[model samples]
Target: MTLFVALAVLAAVVSFVCSIVVWKLGLRFKLYPQIRERDVHTRPTPRLGGIAIFIGILAAFGAAWLVSSLGPDRFSLLTIVFENPAQVLSILGAALMIVLLGVADDLWDLDWMTKLAGQFIAAGLVAWQGVSIVSLPIGGISVGSSWMSAVVTVFAIVLVMNAVNFIDGLDGLVAGVTLIANGVFFIYTYLLVQQTSPFNYFNLASLIAVVLVGALAGFLPINWHPAKMFMGDAGALLVGLLMATSAIAVTGQINPAAAGIEDLFAAFIPIILPFAVLVIPLLDFGLAVLRRLRAGKSPFSADRKHLHHRLLDMGHSHLHAVLIFYAWTAVVAVGCLLTYVLPVYLGTSARWALLFIGVGFVVCAVITLAPLGRRKRLTVAAEEAPAAELPGVDELAGVPETHGPVTAEAAPVESPEPPNGAR
Candidate 1:
């Protein structure tokens, strides 16, 4: 407990300092995001926020190691770092690869396929650490691995990476969601550690999860709407890679005995847990792909058709739209937890929850499709007059146009004399 608390405080401090450094460097270098046709923001903002987040995470891990080694206890939570050196190396290496790839994309626009290929390569490296899902649980039944499981694991990684990236569209959306997700993962994995036959990998996962949350919490204030900085592809992909890898580290590996169930059930629990925790990204990925396919378009194409865009279309301001999405994410997260721990009661809770969800959807739908208002602006003179004495459109009908440059289409049609000849 002391170690974890120290880790959190250390991480927060490192993140806060790194954020300041990154902000200063970004301003100096003029590395800012320009408004693109597809972008929602109308202003230029700094784009190197990822550099701060990455540095913060690395520094936090270092601090954790130092504290574990020096705190009178020769062996500490940081032993997980040395115990699973291969896995640690794999995670760091893959994160570096993805972050660099993303930074490249931000600095010099990379093609979609290029970034996609990079993500796959990084996931493959992480998987090479013997991290792969071998089974799953469905309705209390165990499902074991075949060729299908391998394909599914790889596909899940790819989808999760994109989902995290997709949610990065709004300020604070990805950061806030990432923080929440990691916080939950930290608690879940910590509880798993307390059970008999604890997995050391889970301990390492909690450390990383807390580190991620601390970094995001430190940076979110600057990234929030009316934002001073944009995370850009650099930060988004780093987050995606970190989250997918963390999920893989926890749920993708298994110890049959630790699962505490006979047959395949034990092996399935850990496998299912990661997916359950990442329900939002997984669901968003599925919805995005389905929507694209239904539109007869490539699923990889970018547009203003994301869920966040729909919320904005519904007349919610940017911040409100983001908050609404955040609320939905929290709801899904809570639902997944309920289902996992109390599978029987989840049905009843879900039924009640669905009503509120339906109401939310309807409200957003109505706001998006509603028409503009009917009122018109008038001059101060018109406003000063009594409401009943105000001049009607008919009273000012056929008023002569004010002088201005003629439009190209009307340049040749100017009359030789005014029709009223008042001039």
Candidate 2:
């Protein structure tokens, strides 16, 4: 646990520092595209944030390799940096491949089909590296053939990969959601790794989770509302692949049968945990497809009707909408986490705790959904408002300036005229 903490911190600091460098370099290189009507940002901003995150993850992995190889053997059972070097490299290599795919999409704005081809190819690489989902529990028994497992593995990876990509509608939404999900998975995996019967200290999945949390945490400040740069498809794909890999490692490598988890869902928890953690993203993706289908539009087409966009339409502030999403994600993911954890740690009392938490989540969500008249007025004003001329430097500095004419194309789209952030 101590060693894992150090590695996580290392990744966070490295990601933070590297992101700063990437931010500046992206601006200098002018690697951003012009603003689009369907897009969020009002002004041009860099989309190379993923490159920095990937580099940070790379550095952290390197650090882990060095520490485990040189450190005393006592801690050897706690880390696989020295013991499973191939696994580490394979994970990193898979992530790197996705990053490359994301980078291409971010820069070229590739069509959906081309991007998907890259995603499947990257997912295949992951499965080939020993992180395939080898089984699925249907009844009380495991069910899968070798060929079936390969197909299921690729499909699962692609599902998560695009779920993250499709949900990248608001600033920090994907990163923040994944960060929370990663924390839950880390705790669950760490606890699993603590068992002494079959595996006293096999924490590869835990390591991946914490490292991911760190990387996302380090990037969050820059990605918060009023973002300076976007993670683009590169960061989204890379992060999603990392998350999927962690789940695959546990499900494919570790046996829940050996875990002896005392729950109705114990047999399937390994397979179920990933979906539980990613419940929100998966729901969003599913709803999006249904929505587009009902409208007779291609499922891959982009739109402004995502959940976050709906919140915005309902007159919620950007920050408020994001927080609401975060709250819902926590309630769902954490509730799912407790399903396995509280049972083990809290025993019978876990049932009452789960019930109370569930109630609290519903109440909070209900209150958040309640609308106010002020917001409706604000929305109306924003829609009806005419564009105004850009304020001069003196006006910006709070010094009075003469009125100027607003350009047709440069006019404001909203009443308050704030920067447009993409969904």
Question: Whose TM-score is greatest here?
Answer: 2
**Per-residue lDDT value at 381 in model 1:** 55
TM-score of each: 0.73, 0.84
Model 1 global lDDT (CA atoms, 0 to 1): 0.64
Mind giving the per-residue lDDT tens digits that candidate 1 earns over 1-423? 566666666666776777777777877887764556667766666766777787777877777666656743565445656566687677778778877887787777788899899988887777777555554333333335445545655676777778777766777777887777777667656655565334443266677777887878878878876666766677777777777666655663445543333223324445555555456566766787899889998777676667666665544567666666666555544444443344222323334434554565576445444422212234455678898777764333323443446676664333332111000
Native-to-model Cα distance after best TM-score fit, residue 189 in candidate 1, in Å: 1.4
* Candidate 2 Cα errors over 4 Å, as ranges: 71-74, 78-84, 137-142, 196-199, 252-262, 372-414
The worst-scoring run of ten residues by lDDT in candidate 1 lies at: 414-423
Compared with the true structure, all predictions reach lDDT values of: 0.64, 0.74
What would the C-alpha RMSD of candidate 1 be, to one decimal place? 10.2
lDDT of 2 by residue, 1-423 (tens): 777788788888988898888889888998887776667667788887788788878877787767766756655665553465666777788788888888877778788898888889888877776677765443324336767777788898899988888778678888898898888888877776664234455466777888888888898888887888888889988888888888887764344555443554544556777887677678879999999999998887788777777777665767777777787777766766676666666675446546855885887577577555554554566566665644444443334654556577555433454444644
Model 1 stretches astray by more than 4 angstroms:
67-73, 137-151, 198-202, 252-280, 291-297, 339-423
